[model samples]
Target: MKHIRNFCIIAHIDHGKSTLADRLLEFTSTVSERDAQAQVLDNMDIERERGITIKSHAIQMDYLLDGEKYVLNLIDTPGHVDFSYEVSRSIAACEGALLIVDSTQGIQAQTISNLYKAIEHDLHIIPVMNKMDLPNAMPDEVEDQILELIGGKREDIIHASGKTGMGIENILRAIVHDVPPPVGDSAKPLQCMIFDSVFNSFRGIIAYFKVVNGEIRKGDLVKFMATGKEYHADEVGVLRLEMEPRKMLGAGDVGYIISGIKTSKEVKVGDTITHVKGGCQNRVEGFEEVKPMVFAGVYPIDSDDYEDLRASMEKLQLNDASLTFEPESSAALGFGFRCGFLGMLHMEIIQERLEREFDMNVITTVPNVPYIVHTKKGEQVEVHNPSGLPEQTIIDWIDEPYIHAQIITKSEYIGQIMNLCLTKRGEMVKQEYLTADRVELSYNMPLAEIVFDFYDKLKSISKGYASFDYQPIGFKPAKLIKLDILLNGESVDALSTLIHFDNAQPLGRRMCEKLKELIPRQQFDIAIQAAIGSKIISRETVKAVRKDVTAKCYGGDISRKRKLLEKQKKGKKRMKQVGNVEVPQKAFMAVLKLD
Candidate 1:
């Protein structure tokens, strides 16, 4: 156990964490040079195409240092803020972390956020500056920044280029020298921490865990501490880029155990596994359940595929424990699921996975944050969708979730960034200049404000140089009202949204205009009106198709043409009074993208 090193790589998006992991695998000969793939840890196609790690990958490696064999267990974690929970779980299962920073980019928002997470976990952090081989690399400045951010000695910082494999050997040596081996007793009853799980049709739930105490073997009966379900370990194996079966896993070893359980819900990430007969009396501490931060309604484009979509979601959720869903129905869109995600990116990934992997076409409503509604009856209710909100007469107040937003950008773009933030109802908390040319701005803003296109706007205004990160602070009381869209005096529930009273009129106007552009012309004039509690704030009209009622009377008298026009106008008024507008799916989606 003393020769084992369990560590994970943490970094901001676009940094060389995955690349560094690949090089580490090569240096240890875990994967042959001829067969090694770029970003080997990123197994999903979406990850490779997006150039980001979406899931955390674990592998066991054998390395030789100073003629001594060492067992290295490394986990490569996702760098996005949406996957922070995954990162945290990885950190909990490791004894150390490699904080990789891009030499040219210095410290990004996620870099700082992830660094603090490692610190919180009390892991030995080895700060490493990557991409030193690039022409724009400035190792000295980044070294200073690392020291300042982590408050560590300069000698502790390592420099390496993942592309050219420079400093790869030193990094390996550092792992042996700097990182502490897992500390546990092999004689103790079996206790393990599950960091991840995947479903297999042939076998079952393959739970990847780190043995914190004692040992586990194939055929041993183990129980999940969280769910209190017991199962016999059908198989135990080490992940050497592939599953290699083993009879037993000792303390400090990281491997997967197949329990023959048919459903993924039986095992959960962060659940503790222990011997069924005798094990640790208490469950392991520091197991935090993943809470979703964003909610949206997802439905299949074709109603017949609803069951297919549900099945796909179940399979996807097996891999993604952060995803939460329940049945939901919309008057316009029909039956669907109300899904919750960690963030916007997480929501997008799940939707993409359902369509691409499961071959199901889905439509997603505008994402929303849960709101606390206080009613006149002295009752508190949580509203996840605007359509589910109670009537205004019964509601006393509405509270929305807010986040502490941190944005790092060049000083030249500070003015534009501040204006954008202010427009989103952001309240300035503090602002500091990280350097003479760069600044870090902090604000308390509603989660709904930035969940949509806030990041895109920030990038555009800053010319793609700014990086933003945020975390949910808590819910705050706000003067919020639901803005409803009325189509010919009928409310469309899917088009309803909660907005601040101050910005409702302008946003309502934009929504009405956008809907006008998206909805096709009908037989009668379609009045697209935005209203707040029966008061119309903004309105736009989709004109009725004007047929040539007088075309056949071209050679007739002018009085006959007038008579025909009058009759056509009267018929149009009657159609407008009774006709129902058929809104397309695109029109509902258009309201969401309205800036």
Candidate 2:
């Protein structure tokens, strides 16, 4: 155990965390030179194509230092804020972290957020500056920033370029010298923490865990502390690029256990596993459960695929514990599932995966944050859909979720960014200058405002130089009203949304116009209107398709042409009175993207 190092890499997005992991694997000879690939830990095709890590991966390496052998377990984590829950789980299983900062970009918003998480875990942090090979590398400035953030001496900071493999050896030596070895008691009863799990078609549920106390071996009976279900360990192994069977795993070692569990819900992440015989007197402390912040209803384009969608979601959820879903039905979209996700990006990734991996075409409604509705009878209910809200007469008031947001950007664009924030109903909390050219702005705002298109707009306003991060601050009182979109005369519940009363008219108007553009012309006139209860706030019209009713009366009298036109007009009027407007699926999605 003295020669074992358990650590992970944490950083902001695009900060070379994966690249550094690759170099470390290469330097330690974990993967052969001929078999090595870029972003080896990021095994997902989506991850490789997007050049980002979406899932946390663990690998074990054997490194020889000064003719002495040492075991190094490195877990690579996702950098996006949406995957913060995944990052926390990975951190809980390690004893130390490599805090990588891009020298050219200095410190980003996510960098500060992830650093706080590492500090919360009380892990030994080794701050390293990466991307030193870039021409615009500002190691000196970034090093000063790191010193201020971590309160370390200048000499303590390590410099490395993942592209050129510079200072890779020093990084390994620093990990062995600075990061402390995992401390646990082997004599105690078995205690392990399940940081991650994956479902295998033939092997069942494979749990990735770190042994916290005692030892676990094949055929040992283990019980999940949370679920209280017992299972025999079918296999025990360590991850070395791939799973390699091991006789047993001792305390402070990271490995995988095949428990023959069939479903992920049975072997959840952040659960404790211990010996069934009660050798250990206590359960390991697990991380807080992940709660999704965004909710959306996803339905198959074809109603017959509903069962297929459910099956696909179940399989996907086996690997992603953060995703939550339940049966939901829409008046217009038919039966489907209302899914919860960590954030917008997380939701997008899931939708993309369902389509790409499962071959299911799905239509998703506008994303919403859960709202607390106080009824006239003094009862409070949480509503995830606008249609689920109570009537206006029976509601006393409604509360919406808010977030404390942080923005880091160049000083020159602060004015534009602030204006954009103000339009989204963001209140300024504080603003300070990190440097003469860089500034950090803080705000308290509704989570709904930013979840839609706020990030895209912020990037456009700042010319792609601003970085943003936010955390939920809980529910707050708000004057919000539900805006319903009506096609012809019927309300489309799937298009209903809750908006602040002050901005309802303009947003409703924009939505109606967007719907008008998206909905195709029918045989009869179509009326697109946005309403709040009985009040019509905005309206747009799609005229009926015009046909050449008089074209067939060639060389006829003018009166004959008039009679033909009059008959056609009467037919349109009758059709408009009885015909129902058919709203295309694209219309529902277009209104949500209207901003």
Candidate 3:
């Protein structure tokens, strides 16, 4: 245990965390040259293609230092704010963290947010300036920022280039010398913290955990504290590039357990694992449960695939515990699950994964944040869907969730960033210059405002120089109203949204216009209206695909043509009464893209 080092790499997105991890693995000979690939830790196809890490990957390496062998467990974590939950879990399982900041970009919002988490966990921090090989890299400036953030000496900061493998050895030495060894006793009763889990078709569920106390071995009878379920440890081993079977894993070791549990719910992430006979009295205090920032309905494209979709989500949830869902039925989309996602990107990635990984085609509704509705009857209602909101007559006030958002950007883009945030009803809390050119802007904004396209807009406006991070700051009272989109006279519950009253009419107008373009023209005219109760705020019409009945009577008298046209009009009116409008899948998605 003295020679064991457990640590994770954390940084802002595109800060060379994966590349640095690759170099570490290569330097330690954890992965061979022939088998090595870029972003080796990002095993998912979506992650590789997007050039982003989604899941926190753990791999153990055996490094030889001065003829003495040491065990190094390195966890590569995602850098995006949406996957902060994954970072928190990874931090919990480690004794130290490698805070990698891109020398070219300096410190950003996510870097600060994740650093606080590590500090809270009392983990040792090894600050490293990555991407030193770039011609434009500003190691000195970034080192100063790092020093101010963590308050360490200048020589303590390591300058490393992941591309050229510079400083790799230095980083390794620092891990062994600086990072503290994991503290636990092997003789104590079995106590392991399950940090993550994945589903395997043939092997059942595999859980990745760190042995906090005592030892676990193969064929041991283990019980998961949260679920109160027991299963045989079919296989117990340390994680390398692949699973390596071991006779036993003792305290301070990170490894996996194959318990042959088929259901995903049987093995919960962040649960405590112990031997059945003598287990710890208390559960391991894992990180806080994830609070989803956005909520959307995910329904199978075909109704018959509902059960398949459920199974797919269960398997997906085993890997991504941040995703929360419950069964719900929509009037327009039929049966589906209301899934809570960390953000819009997380929601989009899950939708894509369901289709690509599980072959389950799905439709995702417009995303929204949960609202607290207070009623005259003195009842407080939590409404996730606009359709769930009570009538205006019965409601007293509504409170929407807010977030404390931090954005780091160049001083040149400060005006544009502030403008964008102000337009979203964001109130500026503080603004300060990290350097003469780099500024950090803090704002208190409604979570719903940034749910859709705030991140994308911020990136575009700042020319990708801005990094943003946010945390929920409870709910505040707001002037909110429920906007309902109607086809003819019938309200489509799926199209309803809870929005700020001041922006309701304009947003409603935009939705009506957007829907008119996506909804197909029917045999009769379709009245597309945006309404608040009986008041129609905006309206658009999709003219019917009319057939010229008077075309055949070209030579007839004008009166005869008029008579034919009149009859056709009457027929159209009759058809409109019975014809049911079909809302295409594209229309539902178009609602999210409304600018």
Candidate 4:
């Protein structure tokens, strides 16, 4: 245990954390040169295609220094703000963290945010400046920023390039010299904290954990503290490039356990595992429960596949504990699950995974944040969907979730960024200079405002230089209204949304217009109307596919043509009253990308 070092990699998005990890693996010979690949930790196809890390990956490496063999357990964490929960989980199980910052970009929003999290955990931090080989790398400027952020000596910073494998040996030496080994007693009762888990068709559920105290062995009877279920360990192994079977895993070692647990609900991330006969008195204090930032309805295209979709989600949740869902029904879409996600990107990834991994075709409703509703009866209720809001008369007020947003960018883009936030009903909290050229702007904004296109717009306005990160700051009272979209005279519950009162009219107009372009024209005219309660806020019409009944009566008397037109108009009016509108899949997604 004294020679075992546990650490995780943390950084902002696109900071070369995974690439640096690849270098470390190669230097240690954990992965052969012939088989090694870029972003090897990002095993998912979507992650490779999009060039982002979505989940935390763990592996163990063996390093020899001064004729002594040391065990180094490394976890590669996601850099996106949407997957910050993964970083937190990774930090919880480690003794140290490698704070990787892009030299060219300096210290960005996530770099600071993740640093604070690691600091809170009392984990030893090793500041490493990555991407030093780039022609535009600003080592001197970024080193100053790192000193200001962490307040360490100038010599403490390590500069390296992940692409060229520069300073790989120095990094390894630092890990052995600076980061402390895991501390625990092998004689104590068995206790391991499960940091992550995944489902396999042949192996059931495989749980990855860091042993905190005592030791676990193969075929041992262990019980999960959270689920209170007992199972015999079918296999126990260390996480290497592959699962290396071990006779036993002592304290301070990271490994996996397969107990043949078939059900997803039986194993949970952050749960504790202990020997059933003489387990630890208290459960290991795992990380906090994940709080979902956005909510939406995910329905199977074919209603008959609802049960299959449910089963797939349960299995997926085993791999991703942050995802939460519950059964919900929609008047327009029928039976579905109301799923909660960490952000818009997280929601998109979940949708894509469901399609690719489970072969389920799903329609997702517009994403929204959970709102607290105070009623006239002195009751508080949480609303996730606009259609779930209480009657307007009974509702006293609504409180929307707010976040403390942190944006770091060059000084020149501050004005444009501020304008965009202000337009989203954000208030300036603080503005400070991180350095001579970089400024950090802090704001208090509604979570719903940034749910859709806020990140996209901020990137475009700053030319992809701004880095944004935010955390929930509780709820605040707001002048909010539920906007309902009606086709002809009937309301489409799936198209309804809860929005701020001031922006309701303009957004309603945009939504109606966007829907007009997406919804196909029918034999009868379709009246697309946006309404709030009894008052209609905006309206657009999809003209009917007219057959020109008067064409048949051409060259006849004017009265004959007029009679033909009148008959056709009456028939269209009757058709409009009875005809139902078919809302296309694109229309549901269009509302999210509305300008």
Residue-wise C-alpha lDDT for candidate 2, range 373-492, written one tens digit per residue = 999899999999999998899999999999999999989999999999999999999999988788999999999899888988988998878999999999999999999999888999
Q: Candidate 4: where are CA atoms >4 Å away?
A: 554-567
Score residue 54 of candidate 3 by CA lDDT: 94
**Local lDDT at 185 for model 1:** 91
On lDDT, the candidate that comes out on top is 4
Give the winner by TM-score: 1 or 4: 4
How big is the RMSD of model 4?
Answer: 1.2
* Residue 36 Cα positional deviation in candidate 4, in Å, after optimal superposition: 1.1
Better of 3 and 4 by lDDT: 4
Off by over 4 Å in 2: 279-281, 555-580
Q: How close is every model to the real structure, measured as TM-score?
A: 0.95, 0.96, 0.99, 0.98
Q: Any idea what lDDT model 3 has? A: 0.93
- Clash pairs of candidate 4? none
Order of candidates by lDDT, top first?
4, 3, 2, 1
C-alpha-based local distance difference test score of model 1 = 0.89
lDDT of 3 by residue, 513-594 (tens): 9999999998899999999888999999999897878778869569999998888889888988888898888999889989
